[model samples]
Each structure stands twice: as structure tokens, then as C-alpha cells.
Target: MAVPNAASHLDFVVDPEHPDAEPFYAPSKRNYPQAVKGFYRSIKWAALVATLATYYLLPFVRWNRGPGAPGQAVLLDLADRRFYFFFVEIWPQEAYYVAGLLVLAALVLFMMNALAGRVWCGYLCPQTVWTDLFFAVERRFEGDLHARRAREAKGWTFDRAWRLVAKHATWVLIAWWTGGAWVLYFSDAPTLVRALATLQAPAIAYVWIGILTFTTYALAGHMREQVCVYMCPWPRIQAALTDEWALNVTYRTDRGEPRLSLKKSHAARSRGEPAGDCVDCRQCVAVCPTGVDIRDGLQLGCIQCGLCIDACDAVMSKVGRPARLIAYDTDMNVARRAEGKPALRRLVRPRTILYAVAIAAVGSLMLWRLTTRPGGALAIAHDRNPLSVTLADGSIQNGYSALVINRDAAPRTFDLSASGVPGAKLVVEGAPSDGTRVRIQVPGDDTREVRVLLRAAAPSGAATSVPVTFTVVNETSGETATATDRFETPAAN
Candidate 1:
């Protein structure tokens, strides 16, 4: 049997005699999604506006990050090797925060999938948002589905040609702006805008913008649902991750099966025959961006966007039937309803709870680390060659390198000292010594490497190595950091 509401390209026949024969392949057809209006549609519109506004306008939002720091609120300062998001600054060495963020995002995605299948792909994904915007632009220029199809059937006319030209031009313009907005995160937005406008931006920036423009145009304007259907991996992944309890854009077979037209259904009811609420109007298929028939059940092509819900609701209302014939539902609920049992909604099941707990744990750890981390750090490395030199005064001097990091905004003077070696005297290169400790100064938000020497009388033993602790105490804040390395001495000769 032919697939219900199948696209033109998919409407092909296989020989009944040769059941295993491959079906003829046809090129995919272009989709003209009809305009929809409903609760879910309103949600999508709000999400589109909020997301696009944040994307295009956030770079211009400024933050007062001191005099020397970049003022952009959210920036990836490659030159300085820093990621600044509002008050949070990430150094290259502290890359675990980024990893934690990615983990948190993945957990949240899993949780969303566990709660509602492919909700992210439907509402929040960049492809969906841009394609929705593109569709709006297309409707503005080329009219709705019927008008566009009618115009296409009439061959080339001035009306169709002008509309096509205008639509494509607007699509390209939107794609260009999308690309332009992306590059703003890497630099000061106002300055980069001026440079881009005057053609003074770096060649690499222009190259990236051009590449992004081409991709955005191809994916959103032309590819549209093809990207979701073929290119994206999320559908396959979510299929594996989703359980029967996960709510999806499901056609209620219990309510919609044995479908008939409105007039036929009325006559059948008069004859005391059973008839489903579905009128077989196919509005759900018409408004689908991916041209999927939700009544065929949960297929990979169903993005759970709920446009079909909106479309089916409209149709049901017109026929004076109850809404939600196509709705966010579950296979388990469908089976229960089919068995003449009440539907069950297990939104707070084990999998969802696990995902939520993981998200909260990771998010909390990252926040705690970000807020409570120290403003200074220390690292020490013992010299490999000539590990220790025996001076004429019978003192063993161990050469070492110490890196002092100051994460604060002001310069700090740290007192460097050594312990675990009796009678040890610290000597720092290019630093003043106060008999016991050496004073080293590190610039604000920078690291300073200094050569250090630990001189002490060898203990009266055959011990060739001694454990030594290196400590740096910030003079202003009394904050301290420590590193440990072994001090070596020659075996007794």
C-alpha cells in the first residue's frame, strides 16, 4: 500500500511479483509549509525572537571589566587566551570549566529528550529558528503554499520571477546578517562593525563571514528540512536515548484510526457505525516543515515541533470535534487508551530524575569552583642538570624554577621561602632577599617565572635527596600557595 500523505518523490511503486526489488529513486521535492497559528506556534515565535535578538544584539552589550580588560560582556579573546562571560573569566589553564559546561549542556539535552522527544530540535535549534525566519520571509514575498504552487504550475511569469528574485535576495541578506553577527563575539562589536563597514576588517574575519554566509544560506534557505532529515545526528541519537514514556508528537490512533471524511463520518454515525474523529483532511501534513504525516506514528522525520498539533486542532475545531487528535503523547499512553484504560503520564520517572540530578551536580560544582577558586597559584620545577652543587663552604645549593601566578587585578609581592631542609637559605634571581625569604613581584593577571636557589648545610646522613616545600605568600592579602620538589645532594664520598 502507498504511504499516507507521502511526498511526490516518495510516491513510487515496487513490483508485486518481485517483492525484493529496489524501488525507483526520485529527487526530493521542495516543501511549501503552510502558515500555522496556535499555542505552539506562538511559543515558536517567541523563542525565535528571543534567540535571534540575543544572537544579533548581545555583542553590543557592554560590561565594565576594568580599564585594561575588554569591555565586551561575552567575548572569546583569542589574542589574550581568555574567555570572558560577564563577570566570569577563563584562562587557558583552567579549561576544565569549559568541559564542565559541555557536560552540563549534554545532560540538559538528555533531560529534555527524556521529558519531550526532540523538543530542542523543534524550538531552540539554530537550523529550526533560521528556517522558520526564512519561511516567514518566503511567505511575505511569494505568498502561501497554494499561491506558490499555483504560480509554479503556470510556468515563468513576471509575478513569479519578481517574487523569486525578491525572496532569494532577502534570504541572502538574512544569511549575511546571521554570519556577520557570529563574528562579533570574537572582538569588540562596535569597533568590528566599523571595520567591517569600511572594509578594514582582517582577511580571516571576512573569510569566516563569507563561509558562514554561504552555509547559513544553503542550510536555512534552501536545505531547510533536509538538514534535519539527513544531515543532523540528533534524530538518530534521540531515537536510541528515548524511552516509551517520552512524550512525542504522536497521532492518537485510538481516537484517529478508522478515519473518514466529515460527511461520510456523519452518515456512518447516523447508521450506528463507529467513526474516528480524524476527518483525513491532511492539514497536519500541509503545515509540516518536514512534510511528515504524524498519523503514520513517530517517525525520525517528526521533529516534535507540534505544528501538526496546531494544524490538527484547527481541523478538529472546524468539524466540531474535540482537539488533540494529534498531540504530544506517548506510546504507553496510546496503548493504555487503546485497551480502554486511563492514560498515564510519568514525567518524573527514574531516567528524568537521573538526568536532572546529574545536571544539578555538574552545574553546582562548576559554580562553586568559579566562585571559590584562589586568586594565586604556584608551580616549581627542580633543575635536571647539575641538580645540586656543593659549595666550598660545605653548603648544598639546589637550583629550581618557580612560576608565580597572580589572578587578581593588582600587582602582588609574594615572599618566596623553602622548608623541610634545615638551615635553608632562599636566593631568588633578580629579587631582594631578607636573610630568610626572597621577595618576588608578579604583575596583575600574569605569571612570573623566577630562578630560585635553596642553599643549606647537608644533614649528617647518607640521604641523597631531601623533600622541600616551596611557598609563596602574597603580602597584601596574606594568601599563600605551595609547591613541593625534592632537593638533591651528592652521596658522601
Candidate 2:
């Protein structure tokens, strides 16, 4: 079977001899990547284990929040409109912190791409990680590439049928597990686990799990390379962002040109004829997850995984040739080597520095905001209808809604006062008030909405609107929060 190169849209070859030979499209074939062992493979294994372990286990970890607060280390509490991550808790009003995290992630990805092309795609992408795991299961059930191919050639036998069944069964199991692990993040893991086990979990949770299971199974098992090659937009974006200085999985064509078989190369060298180091073995292609021929030059299908590098190095060692026939190299370096110039590496270029600075700045800003944020908040809104009421006592009263947020672990009373309105008496709808301030209580880690009325003697020839400051002081800790709104009065005719 011929594996169609994803780099080419047409997947057809033009014959130079005929000049006008009719091109015929070749259909893509399923890739059965052969297993290979080397340094890069070891790194990939370690990364796979670490990432999967984190995903499956992090939800089970607990945090020690005070009583009346959820203790999940990381959770999105939709009911309470709060997001908690360890010691940090974000209210709905603080959504900018989440946006900052997203921005920081993008900046870090850009920096990684500037340093090494598609490194994130190759190593840490969810698609790649899941697909690699699926492939491992397939290999375990059906044997390696050669054995599977041989079995396919012999047609479907009982052995092959059973192996296929086992492979697909394992794939579905893993997909289910992956989906199940994801839902644990949104709730208390142990509680959710018991609910799920007892079949008492929420219908929405089960629906989400089913959706995720189907997606994971279909994408990782069947649409593995297709997702990377056709579905994802990152490859196109990365191509636009990359420059010549970026390190990519590249073939050193200068050293391996005029490819020949080992026996032919040996004879040619004996006759003092030109011969390249590459023995023309297709091991690199066989081991590539996307089945890309690295010798065909850098391609969109090449994920920069460095597996081809490992495969080529092993072959080179066996053939007694110097390694790194394929390596993490820049196009400029390849051109330099071809032109007999010393290869130059510019790791700290302006693009990388800019991305690094952006990541650092965003991360620092989010951290500073989180650390310095106050434990209380206040918001006030002036009533629109009947902005002000004229009482019989010749006083103007403005109605307002005040939301007081207490972020502390203990219940606290707040003294709410109004400023900017001279001789104003502040009153809470249900609470007692002194002439100057109203006292209201808020529960720990909760918000209280209170109707507030500010009354002042109507000034003669007074402005129609006056800016009023609403201040809430915590009676226990003396922490304060304030909001400003306009107190409207009747216009003087």
C-alpha cells in the first residue's frame, strides 16, 4: 500500500521524462507505524505516562478549604459560579483571570514553536497523545507492523478476527476511561465516582461522557493522522509563524543525496565513485506515525516528533555511518552546510524573546492580581424607574441595589454608608440603621443583595444629579469595598 503524502494535495507524481504524463490521484492508505526504540522514543513514552497520569489522577487530589467551602483542588463550581484551583478561587466577576491564563498558554505555545517547530503538536497535544496510546493498544493486540501486514495479506482468519475484536474492545475501554476522568474535574471526584458507579449521576454528566467517549474513540483510533493533517488549523498557523531559524525535524540532504542500497554504495565507493551515506532503507518512513518520507524535504505531515531521527540513527549505526542523517535542524543550516559554510544557530532571536516576554508579562499580571485581590467586593446600581422620590418632609430619596460580597471564611457584618450626598441618611430595607450608616450581615463565601435608600434634604437650586459613593466596611476585620453611582434628583424648573 502506498501512503499518500499529506503535504501534497493532489497526491500524484509528474513524470519528467514524458513532460505531459497524465497524473493519476492515489488514495490514502492506513498507516501502521512500526515500533522503534531510541532516545526520542523513550522521551515520548515518559511524556505519555506523565500526561495520562496527571489527567486521570489530578481530579482525585483534595484541598483543605475551610468549612462551608468545596475542598476539591481544582473544580469549576457552576452552581455557585466559582472556579477553585487549590488556594485560588475565582468569582464569576473575575473572568479576566481565566482569559489571562488562556493568553499565557498561547504565548508559551508560540515561544515553543519559535524555538522548535511543532514541538507541542508532536509531544503534548491531546490528539497526539491519545492517538499514540491507541496505536500502542493496536500493536499489543495485532502485533507490530510487519506481522499485521502479513496477517492482512493472508486474509481474515480466526486469529486475525479475534485480535481485531480485542483491539477495538480495548480502544473503547480506554476511550470510556478518558471521558470518565474528564467529568471528575467538575465535581467532587470521590462523590461523583460513587454516583456514577451507583448509576445515580446526573443525566447531563452521562451525556457529556458519552459525547467525549465517542469523540475520543473515533478521533484517536480512526482519524488519527487525518486530524493532524486535515482537521487542525494549527499546522497552517504554525507555518505562517515559523521562520528559517526555527528548528524542525529536517533531513540533511547534503550528506545523504544520491541515495543507494548498501551493497551498491559499497561497490561504488570501492571504485572511488560518489556515494551518499543513506542506504535507502525505508525504516524512517515505516516508523513515522504519519508515514511521511522525511527525505522528501520538510512537509506539513511531518510532526517534528524526532522518531524518524531515532530510526535513522539506529540504521546509520548498523551501517557504520555517522548519525544525525536526520536531525532537528533549520533550513538555513541545511543551505549553509550545502554551500560549505559553517552552520549558524540563533536560539535567542527577537521573535522568541518577544513571545517569552509576553508569556512572562501575562503570567506575572495574573499572579499579581490573584495575590493582591481584596477579600470583599461591592457593586451598586441605581434604580432606573422613579430615580428619586420626594418625601413629604421635603427630602430627596434615591433607591439603589447594593451587592456585598464576603470572600472570607467567617460570617461578617458590614456597615454600609453613603457619601457625596450631604446630610444623607443611609437605610437598608430590612436592617437597622444609624443616621449615617446601615448594618447588614453577609455569610461566609457568599453574596448579599440589599435594597439601599439614601435620603437628603432637597437643596434649593441643587444639581439634578450628584455622584454618590457607597462604602461597605467589614465590622470584624475592618476591610472595606466601595462603589460609585449617581444619585438622581428632580430637575429644577
Candidate 3:
């Protein structure tokens, strides 16, 4: 042995700057997930294709709403205060529907969580889908995990430099298109597309597109699993929500204990010694997008994508052992197997049943409300300051404001009438010269506010405040809407 160099003298003691002495929570290590091919991998690929197609194509779908209304099916017309989704149209006054929809979405997520842990994170989330797309592009240009790692070790060459350029350029294009698709939902898709191409679109649209493009490229392409691990709060919330019965990506430690290499396992079997089929392979870790080793037990880094199951299955097949050494199972089931007891599947437990019932109840209530909705709406506001006025003819007059909402698809006149005291005549200040009980025309899918004067013969001994009923009847459809307000009077002078 040769004598130690000057650098070796301080090696015996811990160095604060050394990696081994650093804290456990170090900066994220870049993950180059190896390509996997199996059942779970196939399912992920299908999900990626379906979700991306829907995002890129749904804005182009069209729906006709008679005349002077948006033709795009899912437009959010902020300028006109309307939200259109296929056959449904929501006005600003009906904002409760949006709250209902958000509640429904939350309940659906809870029900899904009760059945399986974080399935949304694995397959349906936008982050997961876009990240998968970026990964595919990277792999196509840079080869697989081993090749990428080797290339990194050898430093950048001419071929590597070109591949990096092509990969980042593709990512930018996809990000730009994602932003472009988002803006199409706010205006007529074809018209906006032409405007965007001709550089005539509004400055706000371009600004939003630029913001989204940068965020998408940074989050999905550069941040990758860091977003899932550190940025998102779902992983922490999910861990608390998950029950012992909920199926999750799990490794069967009972089958994997006493791990040995392939040769050692075969030798142990021949000698009738205990041996596991794990074979000490790191395929599960290699295929993990987040670089989590499932054998290390569940943690926040695990997205429950099931790629480890595919990797482990392939390894098992090569070793002539049973599959599912890593699969979707519960921790309780894993413990049961270790104890030589029958595994339990409690999918229909009390919590899950309660969640399912809540979902059904909310859905049914929303459906019933939608089916029985009125054709229009009405509101009345009595004058605040001059509550009552005494006319020269001993008649009591009440000034009021009336708003009529037309929910149908065609313009129509509404017959207005007021009743409470006898001989009460309703007069529209600027409407047609029809004496009392005049008709006012309201535009289709719009609200009209107008001033109204209510006159009635003064009763000698009436109460100070009188309740009045205002009704608007649709002339063409015979549909009616009503509102009630109180008219106030002072003591007789």
C-alpha cells in the first residue's frame, strides 16, 4: 500500500461540506425514468392520449343559440356576463349553479379517494398528463435513462447539443399551443384563430398566452416531479384522507424479505433455504418518475402511478416467480399476508357508503332543480325616499323599480300588472301608450329594468305599510313570474 496523500489526512473526520454529512432533505435529484412496457404502462399511455386530445380539441366544438348569441359550446363570455356549456347557459344572477358544480366535483373526488388513493394524480390530473408528454419528447430525443445518464457523464457533444435544442424547441411549441387553446374558449374559435394568426387579436389575449406558455414550460418541462413533491398540497391531504382499506400502490414486503440475487436465490432453493424472488434488482426505482423506491414504503414522493408494479412484474417474469410483488393493494392486506391470514377488501365500508350517498343526493337535487326551472325571473324594488305621494285626485301613488328577466331564446313582450289594493293601476313611464297594465318588450336572454308608477284610490283607514304583488306574464309562452314588495305611507297630515 502507498502512503496517504495530503487530502487523506482530513478524510477521517466528518466534513460539513461533504454530501454524506448533509441533511437528509437535500435538493431534488434529477430523475430520468426508464421506459416501461406492461399493463399499467399501457393504461397510462391511453390516459395521456385521451386527456391531451380533449384539451386541444374541445374549444373548437360549436353550438348554435338562435341569433345574437355565442356559437361556441363552452364559451365564457366575460364581456356579456354569460357562461355557455353546450345546451346550458348560465347568467351572472345564477352563480349558484357554479357553486353547485364545484361541490359536485369535490364530492366526486372524495368518492374516488375512498375507493382508491390518488388515482386522479396518477392518470387524470393536468400536471401528470403534460409532464408525461414532456417526458415522452425528452426520451424520444435523448434516448432512455441509462443513455441519458451516460451522456451527462461524458459532457455535451455535437449530437447531444442538437438533441437538447430539438427537445426544448418541441416543448416550447406544445406550451404555446396549450396557451392558444385556452384563449379560444373565450371567443369564437375560428375567428380568434384567424385574429391570432394575423396578429390582430387583443393585447390581453397575447399577454395571457405568454404567461401561460412560460408557466407550462417551467412547471411541466423543467420542474417535473418537483411540482408534485413540493408545490402541490394534494399529497399531504391525500395521506390523511386515505383509509386502511383504500387500495394504493404497495410493495409486498412479505414476499420480498430475505432478498437475494438470482443465483443466490436459485442456490437457496436447491438447498431448501429461505429466499425471496426480489433478486436485489433496482428496476422498480428505475421506472419511477419521481425516483421513489416502492420497497422503501409509501411516502409523499410516490404518485401512485403503478409504474413500479409494471417494472416489478417484468422482473418477476424473468425470474420465473409470480407477479404482483408490487401492485395495488392495501397496507392491511400486506400485513395480513405476512401473518399468514386471509386478506380483506373492505370497499363498501361506512365511510365509502356515506360518500356515495352524498354524491347521489347532490346529483339528484341538482337534476330536479334544473328540470323544474322557471322560464324567466322577476324582481321589484319600492322607492326608498318618497315612499308614497298623494295625487290631486285623493289617489295614493307608489314609485317602484321593476326588473324582468327573459330566459328564452327569442325576444318577447311581457304584460305587467300590480295588485294589492283595489283599483291599483300599473303604469310604465316610457313603455307603449297602453294606459295602465302596459306591455314591455325584453330582449332574449336579457334583463330589462324600468321605472313603474302604482296608483290606487286611497283607503280611509288602511295600514301604514301595504304589501303589493307585481307579476310579469310572457306574451308568447304564457309563462309568468312574480315578485312582492311593501309600499310605505306616512300618517295623514
Best by TM-score: 2
Please, what are the lDDT tens digits per residue for candidate 1 over residues 1-493? 1234333344456555774666554345788899999999999999999999999999999999787778999999887788999999998778899999999999999999999989999999999999999999999999998888788889999999999999999999998998899999999999999999999999888988898899999999999988998889999999999999999999998888789999999999999999999999999999999989988878888888999999999998998899999989888998889889998999999999999899989999999989987788788998988888899998988899899988898898888888999888888888999748988899988889999988988866778888999988999888888999998886622
Candidate 3, residues 312-345, lDDT tens digits: the string is 9999999889999999999789888888999999
* RMSD, every candidate, angstroms: 4.7, 4.4, 5.8
Weakest 10 consecutive residues of candidate 2 by summed lDDT = 19-28
Q: List the residue pairs that clash in candidate 1.
A: none
List model 2 lDDT by residue over 365-440, tens digit each: 8999889877788989888888898999989988899999989988889988889988998888899999798888
Candidate ordering by TM-score (highest first) = 2, 1, 3
Q: Report the Cα lDDT for residue 434, model 3.
A: 51
- Each model's TM-score, in the order given? 0.87, 0.89, 0.86
lDDT of 2: 0.89
Error of 3 at 474 (Å): 1.6
Candidate 1: deviation at residue 284, Å? Answer: 0.7
After superposing candidate 1 on the true structure, give the runs of residues whose Cα lies further than 4 Å from its correct spot. 1-27, 379-402, 418-429, 433-436, 450-470, 483-493
